[model samples]
Target: MNGSHETEIRELMKSYFDGLYHSSSDILRTVFHPDLAYVNGTTGNYEHLDFEEYMARIDARTPPASRGDVREEIIERIAFKGDRIGIVEARMTMMGRNYQDLLTIINTDDGWRVLTKVFSFVERKA
Candidate 1:
């Protein structure tokens, strides 16, 4: 992808995460594709969740937690396989620990949508 495409998608992704923490569900809808799926491993356990299911969980449990600014270090762009799809890997810091997120994105007629996001959690060592 070109710099403009990358920048736009990255910004939207950041906005997506921030919107979630800030309780702006409307903005959340902008980035997260309805079919998105996720999986994560932390402290030796792996877990998986699908999009609508995950959102239901978030809506039920998250009482609008505090959020810091979104800062991501893009490790690399895996490739844009076609006009419709792309992959990116980045490291994001939350609460002082770095979490790695991999995004599978699609370019719909409206713009880019995050089809899926897989993340690994990093615990802060004492």
Candidate 2:
């Protein structure tokens, strides 16, 4: 694993977590590719959103920070298939749920950007 790539990916993940916590689409745009896909299958049916739809939803949401929700996030693992491809396993809590995210990233001309995010979440217990 290249140390520089790992560091870059870590920083990107941090930005991702912060974006969700703050519901900042501007911040998220820096980390997610324009054509990124957001997918979830926690329920029996599959849910999918393209980058635009996802960003719209984020823009409309009440940020967790505004509600004083405690921010929790962890980068469980990062693995690279080569110099340009990486996979990050992460966990975070938001919107009264704990989310497990599998993020696929690519080293683009601009930098490292998340290409796809497949995630699932479970409601937090009271």
Candidate number achieving the greatest lDDT relative to the actual structure: 2
In order, what lDDT does every prediction score? 0.71, 0.95
lDDT tens readout by residue for model 1, 1-126: 577777777687677667655665567678878888877766576888887777766666443445444444545455677677888776755555678888888888768888888888776555
**Residue 123 in model 1: shift from native, Å?**
0.8
Candidate 1 at 24: error in angstroms? 4.0
Per residue, candidate 2 scores C-alpha lDDT tens digits across 7-104 of: 99999998999999999999999999999999996987479999999999999999999999999999999999989998999999989999999999
Cα-based lDDT at residue 26, candidate 2: 98
TM-score of each: 0.74, 0.97
- Alpha-carbon RMSD, candidate 1: 3.2
